[model samples]
Target chain A: MSFPITLTVNGSAREILLDDPRVTLLDLLRERLDLTGSKKGCDRGQCGACTVLVDGRRVNSCLALAVSLDGAEVVTIEGLASGGELHPVQAAFLAHDGFQCGFCTPGQIMSAVGLLREGHAGDDPERVREGMSGNLCRCGAYQGITEAVLAAQGATARREDAA
Target chain B: MNRFEYVRAGSVAEAVAAGAAPGAAYLAAGTNLLDLMKGGLATPATLVDVTRIPGLSAIESLPDGSTRIGALVRNSDLAHDPGFAARYPAVAEALLAGASAQLRNAATTAGNLMQRTRCPYFYDPASACNKREAGAGCAAIGGATRLHAVLGFSASCIAVHPSDLCVPLAALGAEVEIEGPAGSRTVSLTAFHRLPGDAPERDTVLEPGELIVAVRLPPEAAGFAAHARYLKVRERTSYAFALVSAAAMLRLDGGRIAEARLALGGLALKPWRAEAAERLLAGRAPDAAAFREAAEAALEGARPSGEATAFKIELARRIAVRALERALAGTPERVPALPASPFSAPLANPLPSSGAIAHA
Candidate 1:
């Protein structure tokens, strides 16, 4: 059966007429809305390739049923940048070489942003590694990813301290 | 995934009523259920979305010092709650040790308890898995049985309940509160999950349309929180299922164990509570020898299938002992390193079959 869902995505109100209740939030964002920043890796909860912020908490979009979240706020990787400028996490990824093929970049960046907001990414490298363990990098770019998260966390903390 | 109708339940009554329909499944978090649906394993005609049900996500401390955790409480919130950690450290540790941060954020307490096994044979529809298809015959009986159960396993199915939270919940003696069309009822956490007997298809004792509302932990269990530990042994350090996991809680008086509780995961069809081990440890001094005896008591009835899983008997024993030792030491900061298996090491004579080693 078809259902009509209205939700806010990337600060924009989206009114979608969904024909199938099985459509995942990942598919809705990538296919229906044409916001393809979120990548579908395993299409299972095991891989965090489709990580997004649902009400400011990181969750696997591939596992989130779109019909279930009718009025929730969603923030994808595409929403991270504002006014055509890169977010701190994006800048950090660029500065630290966080990706090789960049297929998993969006998910990793979203997870990092969520991690920093959740207060898990501390100054410790081990903490960063554990915090970012969900977003895998087959390119063996963990060292760079960890470095990027740590740097972004420090910059965000400094910016907050100044404020 | 098959086409399904989705209905957002406004109240508990509405949810229960909708879920009472045939081929209707209540959707909470949808982390595990959606994955099963996508894999063509579960195809419910209607999905009753219960996430928006009011007051199902609150975690409240009762007047008796007990805690009532709502069924919709996310795993991450439960793990990070300082009050919950102080009252149930082993539960918190088990939650943190499970899945990943992203998954924990979305996974709910009821959802975690309701998660199905990760048995490869059960996932493959083509395989003869009794748990997935009744009377289909268990393929894991003679197939890759490394991750199968060692205790309370039947010929019908040997799959284990893959929930780290359940081990500690069983040890803590938590109670599950449920609501159905009739009324509300409560069941002991240990009795919630069922052993795979002739009915391998049924995972829990919940009647049709019964919805788990919350889990209540006794106030007395908080006293054992200081001396509790959870240890999970897996192939990888993170994001992997346990080969053998143990949860232990001990109450000591002058270095003598006054009371004890133990539960094991990845070793049985349900959370295997070591009642005999708890009895063995009571009135004994907390030491290596006493722990060893308790461990031996815990694994007394373990029936390993073959060479691949025969090692689990010993592995579970060692992990149980280590968990007890860590509990006594009160060192929750130290994560247990993965124990090396003797079978994994290279052998000098690979073809040796019961060959005696010559003394040099």
Candidate 2:
């Protein structure tokens, strides 16, 4: 029972052979691919610490099995920036002070990026708050997070989700 | 999580063949199954990956004017579908009201339908739960009876179905299409889920290898689109399970009630469809008094399972009244800033919240 899969991570193709079928996308990204930017807060789907974009949609990486996404495209926190310039969302997070302890920064940023791509929340702070409700900030930084998302949407909509 | 074999079924036939085997489960987006595995509650030996199964992700409009939603279609996609939301507003509202955005993006239609109860005892393996272990004592019987069922609960289980989408679907008379190792069949969504009677472990009537292929809405379901709403009463303002919810849809003719469909969540082992209430409100006017009578009829046989939910009986009746009133007010032009919360959508005449009754 050999499991060989190919996935495009951050526009780079990777061919990997799995020794264990139980490996989740979270485990694969961190342990096998050396992408540790995505944190493992709960190792379950409850917390958004393991959030990542799979095939252009945000999902809980911990809940996704590696073998199930054989030909999928994945984007994690490590792949958000290009060269040295920060993505609009990361820059907005910095400008808006969206993080206090910065533990949930990566997952929060990824979720915000997904939210912008979905384009459900415009400049409305209320919609932004409800859209980002999945990512919990234990440090009570929701106001700034919502602000960052609202600001980032305007900036990213011009660039058409460049990240 | 325990180690298990993974098989990506290429087609429905392959999925049915492998999924029919003992100790094998179907894996779609892995939102619920993986969570259950992490909690040590589910331990399937093999997972038949069905995410990539061909033709299981399309939302098609049938020639019969009914809508067919594929089992693998993501929850977010179904809610955001322009044609679907226009026809079934309450279902969309219920979907948007449930789970966080990320979970909805990964969760699928069938996965949502097959969701397990959120009862604390069911998740806590150390606690005795008849749903988790057959013949085991019910730990939630006397403990944490606040969110337990007020209707269709038995001594074996008091756990309520934790699905917001099911409430609207059941009210709209949706049907579930299933494919097993033997053949294909269909059953109404209302009868799909089994109540906890002598056997609490069996959540649904599916045989071991049956796979839910698609859920089809009847042509008549669209009739309630204009006067339908899903109102969820959660502990918090957003992203929380409902304490009590109601899906109220009405068809009015010349200021008189033509027909009414009411289903409730967080009140029973399944979405409690109130046909008796509908019968009471068939010819009556869509006024407060008629709504009150229908609400009372909806709760005709309801009794608190324990002291924790004693006030919830009154609250459930109030929610039924409130949801009916919202539906009669006409479906909102756009989904409110919040999906199903009563507070989010300003009502024409908000039933003074029968909210949060304190129990000592």
TM-score of each: 0.94, 0.97
**Residue-wise C-alpha lDDT for candidate 1, range B1-360, written one tens digit per residue:** 998888899889999999989989999999999999988888899899999999989889999988999999999999888878877888888887888889999999999989999988999988998888889898888888899889998989888889999999998889999999889999999999889899989999988889999999998778897789888878777778889999999999996999998999998778889999999999998777888888899998888864578888888887887778667766354232221111121223322221212212
Model 2 lDDT at residue B38: 87
Cα lDDT tens digits, model 1, A35-102, are 99999999997768899999899999999999888998999998999998999999999999999999
lDDT of 2 by residue, A1-163 (tens): 7799999999899999998888899999999999999989888777798899999999889998899899999999989999999989999999999999998889999999999988888888988988888887899898888888888998877676676
Candidate 2 residue pairs in backbone clash: none
Q: Tens-digit lDDT track for model 2 on B1-360? A: 787888889999999999999999999988889999988899999899998889989999999989999999999999999999999999999999999999999999999989999998899989999999999989999897998988999999999999999999999999999999879999999999999998999999999899999999999999999999999888887888999999999999998999999999999889889999999999898877888888899888889887898877888888888889889889998888888887774665544442322221
For every prediction, compared with the true complex, DockQ reads: 0.58, 0.84
TM-score of 1: 0.94
lDDT of 1 at A142: 87
Worst 10-residue lDDT window for candidate 1 chain B reads: B336-345
Q: Which candidate number maximizes lDDT?
A: 2
Weakest ten-residue segment in model 2 chain B by summed lDDT: B351-360
